[model samples]
Target: MIKQIPVLDCCTLSGYKEDELLVDHLADYLHKHSSLAFPHRHNFYHMVLFTSGGGAHAIDFTRFEVRPMHMYFMVPGQVHTWEFEGEVNGYVINFSREFFQSLLLRPDFLNGFSFLNGIAQDGAFQVPAHMEEEMTAFFERIYEQVNRVKPLQKDLVSVMLLYVFMRMEQQLSPAEKHKFPVYNYTLLRNFQKLIEQHFTNLRLPKDYADLLYITPNHLNALCKEYLGMQAGEVIRNRILLEAKRLLVSQDMTISEISDELSFNDNSYFTKFFKKLVGMTPEEFRKNKA
Candidate 1:
């Protein structure tokens, strides 16, 4: 049997079975819950602000060096693990998708944040030193408001979270903001979401296009125009990303990974991997090891 990676939920982290929203200081949270350092995928979104600390955080397949004034954003289903050298101080916000979609009444809310999508760029950002106080206040308020749990606490949480997102968006490079498509981008967003959910079973661009109610030609055209790649390439890249993740994060052999990823055979899987990565899966694993 194949080994299964751990998938954590908000309840698991906070140990508060009823609450979907949890906020706590980084150091205290880590000390209180020792199991969080292990590699796991969460079912809820996470926002971490590091006021003081130095470490590296692995999200999905990529490793990001964490430092002061840096905030890391994670969406549900991305595998994450962290290592901190010394005393770490910060704040963590964990919220469910329902918190935003149902409570906040924003269905496509997460799509608005480029960093959260994990396609345009990595999910970590360095905040300017000058804006330290302003950003800290946002988290502080969130911590206080979360603990209060008044009648309108959810509403308060929703508004404050939106403010935090807006503040971070202002810090993004103008080019980064304008480079990707803005208007009418839902089609692409929906296509990407579908790819994430059904990549193992659905490998064809037309497969996703059909699900999105658009022609494969139009999908390819939009991908080429906005993302500078064919729709098929986007699908392949998503698959490739997951392949790399499983290869590196787990002890599974190439054959096992091929089977898990639903490839026809190990030979075809190796060829497909080497074509895009320029290295066979075995070679890549050996190099990483």
Candidate 2:
């Protein structure tokens, strides 16, 4: 019998339950007929390092062939499913909202890579043969720290993981790294993170500025400079994207999507959707369907 797997929740890692970090030797865990799928509602991000084998991985409606030495990253709320045909060896790092918030606050660390945002769409990092030794060394250090006996070893391992990510990010092209501004990049990153976290509850630019301890004008300037759009436009785009996703991907009614997004009423939400999307929500969903 094919075992029915429950949907994995976001905000917490649910599928692989072992608390201790260890290398998952794929031959031990994967079954020929079994597959893994994640929940599409809650928001928790994941970074996956695939060291061997190949498979098909799906994110939302997008699918990719997972080959050896490729790094795959998935954002929260993106529905993901995977099937393996052969050996699968990898490390998956799951981090919570607080973890990402703290990282975004460090400007020097995150500002140089605007290409990171594009990772969801085209974000696979191919491990070069020359770089493989360095990558292996870094992963070994991470695994050692993760499995260490010290009480604070996990925290230390988290820091090492960030370092590893930085090293990997450095391998990207200069054009990719320069996608966003370098100055106040930290603030803009934080704002984007906040918007991702609170898009349903807060849509105003001032709300984000207040949380980041900056003026709305400053936030607007950063968005215009780096994102090539106004700050409000980014927020609205996120909201509308979610609205359309829920509309087409799920059975949620139009009123429910509207209410979930916190509009005054369905009519107002419809107008908002129409203004930006150039089509009503119903029309967009219908066209997509």
Candidate 3:
């Protein structure tokens, strides 16, 4: 019997290979069926630079059209799918949250960065021929140092990677910077972090409220004020989004999905799903498939 590969998080990517930094060029050969391969969110973050071809990429409910010279970032817990046509070339850099935290102390740096904002306002940055040569040189340097046996050299290469990210941030448009609000951003950020961690096991508004050290009402208000949706709505949307992803991509039965989401019972799960989705789980899956 063929064994199945276990699902891995971003942190676990380092352990899979002997050269930790080689995880930087990590690219997966995804076939058509590859979309069904891994449905869970990753713990580590990703910076994907697409060099060629076109496809549909989805994160949460947001989707993007993939083409050459397109760069995208996927933070932990954002469920994503990439469907590619023909050959694609690019580098996928995987680094932990700690890697970024150590470099960007200011919360506004990444919080303000959004692919949507960039595409909407500044237009997707097309790497000029000269710039591509420079980027290739930087990547080659990192690759060589990562493969080096010396520990000091490896650390230096890591620093270079940090420099690359900082440069990329600088290239972002001013509109993108203004999009992210510094104050109260931490609350939203922490709430998202918590949701990614416990969405499967804990779905209640009070659970998140308690974790954030605020009342359920306050949490709801904050989510509403900033996101234009209540806390409960965010929680339910995430759960339902995951449900749809699994239903379309996995062979798991409805009962299995219910158990995975920690629903009280299969019937309750069905009704809850129907109420929000306007159809039974089976019907939804059938329509999608």
TM-scores of the candidates are: 0.80, 0.61, 0.65
- Candidate 1, residues 39-135, lDDT tens digits: the string is 6778898889998888788787577777887888888778777888778889999988778765556587776776788652447878878889999
lDDT of each: 0.80, 0.64, 0.64
How would you encode candidate 2's per-residue C-alpha lDDT over 1-289 as one tens digit per residue?
Answer: 2111243444234332333233323343344224443424325455666777787776554567887777766554665567666778766655544444443566344334543452345355576677887776676666555544445354566678667767766666433465544447667767877887899999889999999998999889887876689899989987876775676644677887787788999999999989987999889877755
Ranking by TM-score: 1, 3, 2
Worst 10 residues of 1 by lDDT: 173-182
lDDT per residue (tens digit) for residues 1-289 in model 3: 2111234455445532432333344244232224444434555566666666777666654567777777676665555556776777666666665554445567445545543221222223555555666676676577556655455354465578766666665666342454655545667767876886788888899999999998999888878876789998888877887787667644688887888788989999999899998999999877755
Candidate 1 collision pairs = none
Clashes of each: 0, 0, 0
TM-score of candidate 2 versus the correct structure, residues matched by position: 0.61
